[model samples]
Target: MSKGLKGKLVLAISSRALFDLSESHQVYLTQGIEAYRQYQIEHEDEVLEPGEAFPLVKKLLSFNASLGRDRVEVVLVSRNSADTGLRVFNSIQHYELAISRAAFSGGRNPHPYLNAFGCDLFLSTHADDVRSALDAGFAAATILAGGTRRAQSNELRIAFDGDAVLFSDEAERVYQAGGIEAFQVLERESARSPLRGGPFKGFLEALNLLQREFPDDACPIRTALVTARSAPAHERVIRTLRDWDIRLDESLFLGGLDKSAFLEAFAADVFFDDQAGHCERARQVVATGHVPHGISNPLRDLPAD
Candidate 1:
């Protein structure tokens, strides 16, 4: 294990998540691994287009330039074998992204290497990999094929769902079993008590630490909490953030309203939610990551939305 990456914010992203490899992936799906390997070799010189997470990765890497040190690292974790992964490296080089580390598992599960890389976050198009990473206590999301609307401002705006993504799904469990009435009652009763941190808590804390490096007025990174909770239920979330000493640039308690327009209004680069329905709607306006976590995601073997 390399102790040098201890203090840095590290991200492990899949090749499919980092670059647009849908065409090549289709080759693999229709044909077999041998055909896919040949296709990649034939197109080794061609550059792969950016995927949903590419812009976010660029913004993340930009922090190093502002801080004048390698404070953030993005490592490529893919199922493609090294021989077939040459195109991915070529694409990274073409984009001039400062990502040199990689773990090509040759179609095996690569979540185990995330711990070795000391990854705080993991993004992948593969749902199973994301679920495995989350199961291993790392913040992970399945990157969806979302809209192409990138934030116009230089600021990198990231949005997250409250319940499974940031806080534990305890209240969500109530909502799932009982109804919204029961969930609201639970929130009102536990208003003062802070909610437990979820898988993304550590990732959020790391972002906060990075945000502190710059002046608050001029920080390039902005985060928002976009949830369905409203009014009385929101009290617990506020108190939980206070308890954790974490701050968000914006908070939206939509009260079960559609989140697509609000996310577009916020000009978010990416939004994360645990619900497939929310992810399906939000992705229409902004890049979305489906977080398969908490009680909501009981079917682990289901495909990504």
Candidate 2:
């Protein structure tokens, strides 16, 4: 018989995203892979400090305690070969994380395996991997390392941006090519039509399913739509979510106000946005991931120089 990942709420994470492997990553950058492998082997027993995505991962796994083990699974999927990954396993053991499965993809990009693993989300610090994962049609984000580490709260709070994130970049492309007024006008006109879902739609649907596991308002997870859209423009967002049959606990229309303060007030465990600028500020207040999608990711137009 063969094992499969078909029905579980899967999170395929990179080793670096699960633990603090910065020192070893530096060695790989400056010294080389051999030196990095040797270093990880030597430090096999050292408990790693939590990385940016640690709290979120831990909390996601916590859902299993109530939802049953079959409901959630976290796979340690990364480019690290088995030889250099012992330290990561050791750290997982030391911290007592519930993750057990792994796929050591060596030098190859692991994004392809997201579907193989039925991954609802794929998070890594590697921008290339993230981009590849998104391109491959998985809900993916680049974990921003060295952010203010968020302590695991009793309730899981996830925040997401509107354009290029929860909703498609259709209106955002208009905003980027035209201007704020143009964007607002188009959004207002399309208010009744309901914007299309973005890349995280499946991930959010998975989360919504998890929220349903609990009866009534007792679900431990709460979500927020913290976006820059304001006024009549906000109508499309609301209609879009309704059209998708998705419900968010809170929606903050900042109209381009800095989102850090609002996210802080919401106490988000993790925040996702397509822009590096929003993630920079969000990470300062909470754990943040850069969803490198839509028109914002310029590498699509201009090759890496």
Candidate 3:
């Protein structure tokens, strides 16, 4: 296992992702949310689940083992109920699901807590939690647009931007903070320099480990980098990946072009970037994640709500 995950495949999933009532399951696990929240407040540690969500958790655990990934680690981040955690654990055992770790949180927000757990990725119903995970240096996704189960084929197609996903956002920060002129100056001076680390570097390492475990000789895990930076800016991105010993199947430096069309062509299961505009467009074409700007990136003006 890579040092990123600390030798564990830590996945932080919301309570809802574990169970789907639309499917057939007698014991509904969704009811215990409020109870679970209360329990957590009273007792320090507890795991809760709604009646509708347990079967799905079992399925996820089975899938994790089948994929050779570590057993699923679930954290109930919802504040709805305290009893939810206990109910969830009981259902997991009742259904004989294999789980590596299970924990519950108090009224505290789930995303920051997830960071403390060293979670590699977070799955949740709340969009804020997803965004928070990305900001906190973790790969995160919400089940809004679609489900990961849909990508159950032998190959999984994943896409990301070059600047802030694979490489550090320092250059982008310069551009945002000091405008195009300052950015140009920095890029020109740093032309021969290597790219720095970004949010998804750890994720790339994890994928490499997975590749070693499950080699896809014919149909490998398809990966791509779609970015707006062209030519001169692109060289640093490529060199950085090479230096880090990272492998990418496809990379497109679009030179300020919209990435939606290319992402559609790639048929990506998931695409990630720090810009909401790109995410807004790509979400229509594929599963998309909006990686929050790192603290170093200048805060752009927020549109009025």
Top candidate, metric TM-score: 1
Error of 1 at 215 (Å): 0.3
**How well is each residue in 168-204 modelled by candidate 1, as lDDT tens digits?**
9999999989998999899999999999999899999
| lDDT, model 1, position 100 | 97
How far in Å is the alpha carbon of 101 misplaced in model 2? 0.9
Q: Which residue runs of candidate 1 sit more than 4 Å off their true CA positions?
A: 1-4
Better of 1 and 2 by TM-score: 1
- The residue pairs found clashing in candidate 1 are none
lDDT of 1 at 16: 92
Model 2 poorest 10 in a row by lDDT = 296-305
Q: What tens-digit string does per-residue lDDT give for candidate 2 at 176-250?
A: 899988988897788899888899988999888888887756788999999998898988888888888987889
How well does candidate 3 score on lDDT at residue 261?
85
Q: Which stretches of candidate 3 lie over 4 Å from their true place?
A: 1-6, 16-82, 85-100, 112-117, 125-137, 141-152, 177-185, 216-220, 295-305
lDDT (C-alpha) at residue 117 in model 2? 78
- Candidate 1 vs candidate 3, TM-score winner: 1
Candidate 2 stretches greater than 4 Å from native: 1-4, 300-305
Better of 1 and 2 by lDDT: 1
Q: TM-scores of the models, in the given order?
A: 0.97, 0.95, 0.69
